[model samples]
Target chain A: MLLNVQNLQAQVEETEKQILKGLNLEVKPGEVHAIMGPNGAGKSTLASVLAGREDYEVTDGSVDFDGEDLLDMDPEERARKGLFLAFQYPVEIPGVSNKLFMQTAVNAMREERGLPELDMFDFDEYAKEKIELLDMRADLLERSVNVGFSGGEKKRNDIFQMALLEPKLCIMDETDSGLDIDALRLVANGVNTLKNDQRSFIIVTHYQRLLDYIKPDHVHVLYNGRIVKSGGFELALELEENGYDEIIKQHQDA
Target chain B: MAKKLSPVAQKARDFYLHEAGKLGDASSGVLKQVRDQAQEAFAEQAFPTAKDEDWQYTKLTGFVQNHFAAVQTSEEVAGKINAYMPSFPVIKLVFVDGNFSESLSDDLNELPDGISLESFADTLSMNNELDKVFAGQDKILAEPFGSLNSMLMRDGFCLQVSANKALELPLYVLHVQTKAGSISSLRNRVVVGENSEITLVERYVSAHEEGAACSNIVTEIDVAKHARVKQVIVQQQNDSSYYFNNQFISQADSSNFNTFFASTGSDTSRHQNHLYMNGEHIENTQNSACIARQSQTVDSRSYTEHNDEHGFSRQLHKFVLDDKAVGVFNGMIRVDQKAQKTDGQMDNKNLILSNTAKMDAKPQLEIYADDVLCSHGSATGQIDENQIFYLQARGINKAAAMQMITKAFLLEPVEDINNADIRKWITDQLEVALAKTHLPKA
Candidate 1:
């Protein structure tokens, strides 16, 4: 298994809010799993926890990524270990160029994997290939990170970064939110281009529209901090036809 | 007003009184008079206490008590300072212990036409311009240190660029301090005539490791009508030395003046800039970057006065203070009543790397002209934890992430420099400073 999460329980830092309660999940290599739910169903919290966001405290859980404990690591450590989270709200860091940020990040991963660091000229060439593949603006590499970028550009930039990192497992939190149809298609295309048998993906979203572009092998219904229902791709269509109310009620009654 | 001088001020007075005859030359007649008047003013006033409004944050009790001796710079000390020179190619004029060094300097014959670079006394004999520069400057005698500098400065340089001529290369004045506990006073002047353009760099390098020595330098720059001048002041003394500087800048009609002050050393370094927009449509930009660590203190104060119509000035200051260091910035923009359509702004940003570090910032704008548009703002805080997380999330270690953020924060001030070499030099300086500091994980 690429990722195995057993009996996961988590809460917000410095608060009594339990965001996730006894959630269990599993993903093997090359499997694309779509986690869909209504509002406040811990969809984003699960992503944050996996990415090692400091505010999300794991009370009880064991997250095994490629036979290593994941919860005990820092965000950077998780990233170096090939776990990537495309944030829902990408931060705007002024005075920092996107190229420099990516170089620092990529070389870090390279160093851990015993790969030689890229010099400035070589790094620029490396970034250029990914930049062209994503069809991002040439000027985007020179601009400060997400500063003065439009909502769509910021989302596209996040996908651009994900493509460059080439992580083993990618967790995208609400990647479809706040994006137009064109932007939505671009993001799906980016994911499709980078997909391979050795990598895996877990997509978190509230709508089923995104599922039309990039097909998910398995669809799971997340309700009230638990995976209430799990099925094949047909589950996303079923939830689209009938709202989350009926499905969540079924789990509540059970 | 009759008042007994404080012991510090008394020492300062006597020191100048003793050095007056040795410092004066026959051609510097007006400068002698100015020095005499400044000494009289110093006798009536005393060294300011910590309670004084302008000197409230920085404690100078220890500095005020100790007597700093003035010494003649030796060739051995000048040789040691040559290793710290900037890598850029320029006509270098090196000063050792406030005295101009002829043996360790480049040939002055290399200067272009319409430009005259020589010792201070030589320029004094050339013209009566010193009288005009100090005509009404005595009114500023209230500043104790400025008055003291005017009274005791023995040797420096005079650079004059005549009207309608532009220099092809930047002129560098590097001051090297080698004597411990010895005070060095210098008076340097630059005159850029109408339609002339030039760039100058004034820097100080000290060899003292833990000495109580001080370097007091005063530079008077006069930008004539329609002239353009760029000045870069770099102070990278060792941590144990003291540097007190007062820069006097005046811009005539339609002239443009630029100043870049980079301070990365000294135990107690204080820089005061006085910019006067004396004519209409003048442009003034002054930017200061202070990177201090350990127990050092860096104080930056400025008063930009827009006295004419259509004047514009932008003041920016960036400070990164760590350890138990303290950073201070106090800036004021004043628009006179008749100065209509004036636009000015002041910005101060500080990054405190540790909880023990402190930053004091005060940005004020006094606009008497209703038509003027002026703004001022200051922010003092440590690195944002969210920003750190954002960097760290990308696989950069915490300490390296903090360094990146601090570098970017400090780079904004030097980004607009027209000289790429100087900009690169400043970036390298910031990197060197970062290596010595360890930013605690946020």
Candidate 2:
């Protein structure tokens, strides 16, 4: 298994309100798991907690990623250790170029993996290859990071970053939220192109529309901070046709 | 009856009366008259106190209480300072202890036709242009340090570019301090004729780090019609030095002026820049980036006056304060009634890196014309935690992330520089400053 979580309980920082309650999950290598839920569910909170965001406090539970404690690392450390989170909203850094930002990130991950850092010339060529692979505009590397970019472009940029990093486990938190149909396809294509036997994905979304483009091996209904129901790809189709009201109601009644 | 002077002012007066003759060639010519008049004015005004509105934020008690004297520079100290200067490919004029060093400076004959660069004494002997530069300096000379500088200033350069001539190379003026408890005063005048262009870089550095010293400077620049000028001033003195400067810029019709000032080291300093738009269709740009750490205090003020029509101006100033350091910015844009169709914008941003750091900013726009467009704003805050987290999530460590963010913030003002080499040089200087900066993580 690439990631395993047992009896997970977490809350918003400095608050009594629990966001994640006894959430249990298991993901083997190369499998895509789709987490579908309604508003106020723990879908995003789970993503944030897994990424080691300080805003969320993991009150209980153990998360083991490839035999190592996942919660013991900083956000950057987790990133260096082959964990990637595509932010829902990419930040705009006015003066830092996209190339510089990605180069620093890539070099950091490489250093942790005991690989030599790429110099400027070599890194530019490397980034250019990834840009072409993702079919992104070449000028995107020259412009400031995410500054003045369209919503779709931002999502595509995040996906392009993920493609560059090539993490083993990717947790995408609503990557399709502000994207148009074409951007949705580009993001899906970027993910589909990068998937391999050793890579896994945990996709968190409010709507199942994104799951249609990037097919998931399994689908789970998240309600009241726990995974209440789990099924195969057919579950996503059923949720799309009926919506989360049915699953949420069934979980509440049970 | 002459007003009683403060102890600091009295020290300056006594220095002028007793020691001015040996330090400068100001015994004869126009410099003599200017010094005499400035001495009278300086004796009447005391150092600025906290009660003064302009000096409210920056405390100068320590600077005023200490006695700084004029000292002679030895040959060994001059050699040490000469070694400290950079070997940039430019027409360099070196000044050690406020006196021009013939051995260290480049040959003035290297300058092309229509361009003339001369020392203060040489220019005083040739023409009365120094009189015109000091015509309206009485108001400034009535102030405490302003008058003191005028009375004691002896050695600096006078640069003149004739009509239709452009200098192919940038001019560098390097001021180096070596003696402790010394006061170095300098006055420079720059005049660019119609349709001429020039780029000037003025840098201040210190070779002595153990003792306290002071540098008082006055510079006047006149831009003729259809002329252009770009000036960059970098101040990297020791932590024990005091720096006070005044720049008077006057622009004519269709002229352009751009200036960038960066100060990274000083115990206490004030850089005052005033712009006078005397003609229509003028363009003026001013930007500054300053870093203060420890108990350092940096005060910067820019006052631009649009007296004619069709003038445009923009100013962006940034500051990074750490430890108990303090930063102050006072910017004002005044558009007169006759100055119709003027456009101006001013913004000041402060990034405080410690809980004890403080920033005081006052940006004002006073426009009497109805058709002009003007806006001014100021923001002071700590590093954004979200920005930090965003970078950290991207695999960048917190320290590197903070540095990248801070550099981007400070370099935005100088992004429009056209010369890539000069821009990179300035960027390198800022990088060195960042290495010494105290950047606390959020």
The stretch of ten residues in a row with the least summed lDDT in candidate 2 chain B is B74-83
lDDT string, candidate 2, B146-214, tens digits: 787877776688898999999888898888888878788888889999999999988888887767788
lDDT of 2 by residue, A1-254 (tens): 88999989999997768989899999999999999889888999999899888989999999999889999999888888888898888888878898889899999999999999999999989888898998989898899988999988988888888888889999999998978899899999999988888999999998888998899998988899999999998998888899888877787835
Error of 1 at B109 (Å): 3.6
The candidate that wins on TM-score is 2
**C-alpha positional error of residue B363 in candidate 1 after TM-score superposition, expressed in Å:** 0.9
Candidate 2 colliding pairs? none
> Per-residue CA lDDT of candidate 1, range A83-168, in tens?
98888888888789999999999999998899999989999999999989888788888999999998878888888888878899
TM-score of each: 0.93, 0.94
Can you give the lDDT of residue B221 in candidate 2? 92
Clashing pairs in 1: none
In the range B321-364, model 1's lDDT, one tens digit per residue, is 88999899999999999899999989999988888889999999
The number of the candidate with the highest lDDT is 2
* Model 2 iRMSD vs. native: 0.9
Candidate 1 regions with alpha-carbon error over 4 angstroms: A237-243, A246-254, B2-29, B124-129, B440-442
Quote the positional error of residue A171 for candidate 1 in Å. 1.3
